[model samples]
Target: MSDSYPQSALREWRAHMGHPATLVAILGVGLVLGVAGPFGTDVRLTLLPRIAYWLITVLLTYSAGTLCDAMLKRPLARFGFWVHLAVTALATGVAILLVLLVVNYIVYGWLPDRDSLPAFLGTNFAIAIIVSVVLATVHRQSTPVEIVSNPVRILDRLPLDKRGPLVALSVEDHYVRVQTTRAEDLILMRLSDAIAEVGDTKGAQVHRSHWAAFEHVTTARREGDRAILTMNTGTDIPVSRANVAKIKEAGLLP
Candidate 1:
């Protein structure tokens, strides 16, 4: 069950993080909030400050949870990526409040009630979801770039200069479309099996259909609450909560 798609899902998320669109998304959220306010109340709510805060806090906490998954499967796996997301959301909410309280107490000598935690986190959660989803959707639509000419490098026995690599070796539907260099070739192997085979190759499976090479990863992007990785091939992959940390610790992320 673990091999089915969670690994590949993790790989895909890592790939979406680098897209310019992802940044635009974060900015767009800020832009909208800057104009409308955090809750979009008629007055200036100014969600940008909170948005920025949670973006950093959430991604860090979420990635940390994902890294834990890399070592062992937990009851958390049963809920799939959503569980990681929930924890991230909760952690971000708590972290933000803690920061605000500490700063306020030190500077202003005031602290809000802990009972208000729900309202505080809820507002930020809504904003994060909105921005993150937009980026994730944009990222999902991008095509994956494949390295076909370099197939020889992937083959264990042959030198890249010697023989042409075999074509049609594997084909798995990918969340990120791949375009091989010499010619586009669909990897004929099962998505799960392919990732397992390359487990030692400095890569992670991000989704059922996405497998990103570690050397090919360029940056990590966050769309509101979701995380994506931008690959060297210029493709975005979705990162499942279950495998986020594994891919990160593998040094697949920047």
Candidate 2:
């Protein structure tokens, strides 16, 4: 069960990296670079050896870059597109450069001298930015863009990463706990105010301190004088006596 947000992220990461097109693209890049034999490899080695070098370099660099990108992309999403792109690119660039350095060292048996380091690093960083822009665009296109256009004013209270279908809400002192399908976070607002901001989403304040979306209500059972409504997120919210009929009217329970 995806009770954990981190587990949800891990599953998405696996699906993205293991896609058949991604695998083919990796192979295609390696093959194209192998044939091109850039960076003096054509002069230094025979055709087959040069091809192998490019293939290995591309494979190693892509592996490092993709892993770094996956790790940072979600966390940085809150920062907006440009900031996220710059940060992820720099980080993923460093990872790719380090792997590229190792692979290049194996081929030439030498490291860059101090004088050439600046140019070498600058070239790699520039390349990294271009790669990052492409990646960021692809991801942006694939991601659903509902939050910006959504009529629900309450969604504005959540970070981009935590925003999704509403599950439940609760008051903890001064903070209102907003639980969405993707992740949950607390906003400093009264329970009543939060419920008001829910806008068009079909939901109700189940208790004085709790709110639950109608579609997200999964199970309900009577406990003593009150009823407990189970949300799809596995949270059991205590229903007040006053709202018990309201819950029954929603067809969530008999």
Candidate 3:
């Protein structure tokens, strides 16, 4: 589960708060709050306790929200927008509340009472909901970018310079040929293993011997009853008859 969770969380993060601009915005907010201090109290025994506190809180909250987003994605996809938002809010709220409790205890030795816990939880919930909504909007407005920018677990077998936006993977005897935008390399791994390593990159096995990244597909054409995908690098990949319908439903085929 741990192996799959990070990949799932990474995909969700890219879908929402993974943009470079969103990261800049988060850092900017952290800087403002750090200097200003909560409730305008800047008194500190240490050199930068306020700044540290603010930055830590921002990191924790965002991490919790991203994790919850990944965990709830599949289950919530079947529901309406409002239901997704509600579940996300509730889960993120609980995560934030727990994070705040730990952070407060560490930074100020403060613990909430039964009476005070409700108010604290409510405040954290409100903040989480707002952040989630704002980030979701930003994600919607931004242009779709490469989802494979992060280092892939499977690509570690290839040379460092060859790791780039994966174009496709083809089985060659006992080895798999990994084609990235930058370069192509052969690895002594089975196609099935390679596919599992591809993680969250949007792709499907178009043929028994071929899997192509959707983003790298430049054109989709039909050759008789079979489907063909022309990659950006000009490699034409054949799509098996059995997988043609699945690729069409994914909008990778016409």
* Candidate number achieving the greatest lDDT relative to the actual structure: 2
Against the reference, the lDDT scores of all candidates come to 0.44, 0.73, 0.71
List where candidate 3 sits over 4 angstroms from the true fold. Answer: 1-6, 11-19, 40-47, 137-238, 242-254
* RMSD in angstroms between candidate 2 and the native structure over all alpha carbons: 7.8
In model 3, the clashing pairs are none
Candidate 1 C-alpha error for residue 67, in Å: 9.8
- For residues 1-254, what per-residue lDDT tens digits would candidate 2 score against the true structure? 22343554454456545656667777888778778877777788888887788777776777667666656655665565567678878888888888878887887886889998998888987897688678656544422345656777777766555578888888755556677876565455678888877878898888989998989878888977789988887777889888898888988777
Superior by lDDT: candidate 1 or candidate 2 = 2
**Residue 160 in model 2: lDDT:** 59
lDDT of 1 at 222: 58
What's model 3's TM-score? 0.53
Question: Best candidate per TM-score, number?
Answer: 2
Q: Which candidate do you rate higher for TM-score, 2 or 3?
A: 2
- What order do candidates take by TM-score, descending? 2, 3, 1
Candidate 3, run of 10 with poorest lDDT: 138-147
| 1 against 3, candidate with superior TM-score | 3
Q: Name the runs in model 2 displaced over 4 angstroms.
A: 1-11, 142-254
lDDT of 1 by residue, 1-254 (tens): 12334453454334333335545555565555445433323232235554554344444443433333322223333444445345544444454445545544553365557897677657755655554444333322223344454433334322122122222122333211232222222222345544443424556566545666656656776555456776554456677767677676876544
